[model samples]
Target: MVSKKVTVKNPTGLHLRPAGILCNEAMKYQSQITFVYDGGMANAKSVLSVLGACVKCGNEIELTCEGVDEQEALDHLVAAIDSGLGE
Candidate 1:
């Protein structure tokens, strides 16, 4: 498993659209992926779960991936977030 913290830089935070982008990115990998914010954790592949995380702009989130392609999954997800999900 691998984990890294990334701040949400999108002005609107992890709203529906960006969260959907994240979910789409996560679905490209076989690894199990999750996002941790505050004391809550949400499945990265689920838009509803991500929205439930209540993340806002500037929030720090911990992304974790586990399974065969953990490293690649982590890298992609982190890149997605860092790129503002192409906002």
Candidate 2:
């Protein structure tokens, strides 16, 4: 398992489109990926789960993954968040 705290940079945070991107990326890996916001954990592969978390900009979220591509998957998600989800 790998975990990293990522700060959401997108102004609107992970909204519908970016959430789709996140879910799509998460699906590429076989890892069981989850994003933790506050005290709750949401499945990264679900767009609804992500939006429901309300991860606004400047919010720190912990991304965790368990499986073969855990590290890589975490890295990409971190990068995506850092990229402002292409605001």
Candidate 3:
């Protein structure tokens, strides 16, 4: 497993649109991905779970990935987050 923490840079944070995009990207991989924030964890492949986390701009988020392609998954996700969650 691999994990990294990033700050949410988007003003809207992980809402439906951005969160949905994240879920979509995560589902494309055959890896186990999860987002951790506020002492809670959510599946990165679930839009509802991500939105339910109530993340906002400037919040710190930790991404944990485990599987055959963990590194690639992490790299993609880190890029996504760095892109302001595609905002």
Global local distance difference test of model 2: 0.88
Question: lDDT by residue for model 1 over 1-87, one digit each (tens)?
Answer: 999999999999999999899999999999999978997899999999999998999999999999999999999889889999979
For model 2, the superposed segments whose C-alpha errors exceed 4 Å read none
Which residue pairs clash in candidate 1?
Answer: none
RMSD in order of candidates: 0.6, 1.0, 0.7
What are the clash counts of all predictions, listed in order?
0, 0, 0
CA shift of 51, model 1, Å: 0.6
How close is every model to the real structure, measured as TM-score?
Answer: 0.97, 0.93, 0.96
40 Cα displacement, candidate 3 (Å): 0.6
* Model 3 TM-score relative to the real fold: 0.96
Q: List the residue pairs that clash in candidate 3.
A: none
lDDT of each: 0.93, 0.88, 0.92
**Comparison by lDDT, 2 against 3, better one:** 3
What TM value does model 2 have? 0.93
> Pick by lDDT: which candidate is best?
1
Question: What ranking of all candidate models by lDDT puts the best one first?
Answer: 1, 3, 2
Indicate the residue-level lDDT of 12 in model 3.
86
